[model samples]
Target: MVAMVASSLFASLDKDGDGKVSASELRGCMAAALGEDMSEEEAAAILAAADADGDGLLDRDEFLSLAREAECAADEGGRYECLREAFGMYANAADGEEQCITPASLKEMLSRLLGTSQHLGMEECRAMICRFDLNGDGVLSFDEFRVMMHDGLM
Candidate 1:
């Protein structure tokens, strides 16, 4: 059952029905499927997450590769649940009724969750923030942070 759901989800994510997902297509599909409003920065962060080959696009294989990685990290059910819980936590920590989690907040959350320091001078974190900060705001909302973390873990 989980596999079936996962397969369906992957197919839906493969927008354009071309068996491959371009960056724009993936972003649109994710936004639509997740029922989340995303900023340009958020979309870019998602793209970077799924584009494992650094080709700026995601083919079916790449998508599957990400799924496999996630599956390995946690079974499908566990991963899905973790994501749901994380989303809830983020929503609760949002700045206002808008329920938006900023990039700075995301960093803090990740650092805490990962047992890192408040001041992360790691190159990985720097690169992640740079790659996902679409508006040059130097901050990523919950939506953006989720996408970035999804990609990184995968």
Candidate 2:
């Protein structure tokens, strides 16, 4: 039943029938849902968050995860919650709790997203945080994280 629902949603979004969902297709759906167009940055943020294999497209499992999120999200606030849920996926919080996106968590998540078998070095992660850490606290608050995801999009 779940798989059927997932495939149905994926089929609806995979307009090109390429066995993957592109950012453009997703953008269209989001635009309809939000009643306004989504910028390329916002679309890219969604894809970047969900594209586990780093293919720049959403395959079944990836799309299914995102679709499941959207299933519970019906409006703008729900949309934000969906993104937050995606953000939570990469949470590698130390001490078994997450308050923000720290260098260590960013390092782990980026290494996985970049498909790097080796760690993505602490210095690089710190640099990434520095670029968008508006608070200068050496970590990414959700707002900072959103800026980084939507702007830098790495």
Candidate 3:
């Protein structure tokens, strides 16, 4: 079933009657799948991230990887839940009350997000806290995090 679906998808994406999906073809496919015209930069980034070979095109396997990633990322609700779960994982303060992510924890999360080789400096972390801290308590409550995540803060 999966093979048949992938074959059909590949055929659809291989525009211009080409045997392979070029970068432009992949970008068009993504735009169509996402129901919006993706920016050139976004399309290029997706192609670069998924293209295993140096060639700037997506073969069947590469396209399958992109499809899987897009499938996961397209679920906004699931993404939010995953983010909430991450917040909970890092907000581990056994104070027996409502706990929040401290500046230190936020820094750790940011560092992890950016990769361990490039940890954000204290100044950067503080700035992020300042941006997200609604009540100005120097830490992020779950509500504040929700607002930051879902309420147009991006």
Candidate 4:
């Protein structure tokens, strides 16, 4: 099923009737699919992370990776894994060595989640940290992130 979905998505993204998906095509497809444009940084990061063959374009096998990831995100356990992946991604992206999300990164993450670079204010991010930061360390650990993501689950 995921294979079929990936094939269909690949077909749609392969603009200009090409058999591969370039980074630009992927950026446009992401914007159309999400109803918000992805920043160049985001698109580039995605391409770098997912481009398996080092070809600078996504072929069938490469696109299947995203399809599989999306399939995982659709399930409950996979949702937890997805959250963990997101936390790890940000934690590793940060300059600090604590393996946690800094407040500034958290603010940017919130803004991204809100679908705009400036949709979320620093104050709002601070308030959110106050609400979820159990250790009061001014940064979000994976536990804190899980709590925030699963606020309604409990």
Candidate 5:
């Protein structure tokens, strides 16, 4: 099922009729359907993680690799795992650390996940942190992230 969905998704993402998916193509597709405006940095990071041949593009296998990780979103326990992966992807990209996600990092993640043309502002990101930051440290710890996901705050 994931295979078929990933294939179909890949086709939609490959708007240029090319066999592989480029960062721009991926962003354009996300921006269109999900209405999210993925920044070049975010798109590049995704492609970087998925691109197998280091060609800066996503082939079938590459896209499937990402799809498999995301497939976890379907299950309750795995949903947290999926969100953890997303958090790691953006958090690690920002500072090469996994401690916590700052407002800037959250902004980057929201830009890709929201599927909205109007990307979230820093104030919004800060507010999100404020809403979820249990320790009141102005950043989202993994524990806080779990709470946000559990609350379906996305």
Candidate 6:
């Protein structure tokens, strides 16, 4: 069951049906799977996180590693719970704007989404900010946020 689930997850991430996952492909997969838009920078960060070998791409093995982590975390309760938490954080950050997620807001949002008070220290958030801050203004516009989140899916 685990292998099947892992395989499915990997296959999904391997967009374009290619045997290998390039940096761009992985970014697309993350956005699709996470249901968020992604900016070019955000796409890069997601790719970097999944590309364990640092080969600028994600292989099946690397994807499985990430899937396993997500699976384990989800098993604690449910994947939807985690996703819901993330959505709530993002929604709050939106603050009535069409595009609510900014780099600073994403930091706070991810911290809550990942359920970490401080130990993890918002590594994911920082990574996202680093990747998506297009104007070098240290923030992401709604469109940028959407792109980063929804790269491959849409």
Tell me which of candidates 3 and 4 scores higher on lDDT.
4
lDDT scores in order? 0.59, 0.72, 0.69, 0.70, 0.75, 0.58
TM-score of each: 0.42, 0.45, 0.47, 0.46, 0.48, 0.43
The residue-by-residue lDDT of candidate 5 on 1-154, one tens digit each, is 6677678667667766678988888778677545569999899999998787999999988888888876654787667677787567556334565578888977876566444554889998888789888999888878888877666442
> What is the model-wide C-alpha lDDT for candidate 6?
0.58
TM value for model 4: 0.46
Q: Considering every candidate listed, which one attains the maximal TM-score?
A: 5
Once model 4 is optimally superposed onto the true structure by TM-score, how far is the C-alpha of residue 126 displaced, in angstroms? 46
Number of backbone clashes in candidate 3:
0
Q: Give candidate 4's whole-model lDDT.
A: 0.70
Best-performing candidate as measured by lDDT: 5
Better model by TM-score, 3 or 5? 5
Write candidate 3's Cα lDDT for 22-132 as tens digits: 767767655544435777777677677888995877788887776566555758788777668757855747568687888787676555433344567877877877888
Per-residue lDDT of model 1, residues 114-141, tens digit only: 3322345456555666786666655555
> Over the stretch 44-136, how does candidate 4's per-residue lDDT look in tens digits?
777778788888777878888877877665778777788888687555343556677776777655444333423667777677677878999
Candidate 1 vs 5: which has more lDDT: 5
Clashes of each: 3, 0, 0, 0, 5, 16
**Candidate number with the higher TM-score (2 or 5):** 5
Show pairs that collide, candidate 2. none
Give the residue spans of candidate 2 off by over 4 A.
1-75, 92-98, 117-119, 151-154
Q: Enumerate residue pairs that collide in model 3.
A: none
Cα displacement (Å) at residue 80, model 1: 7.4
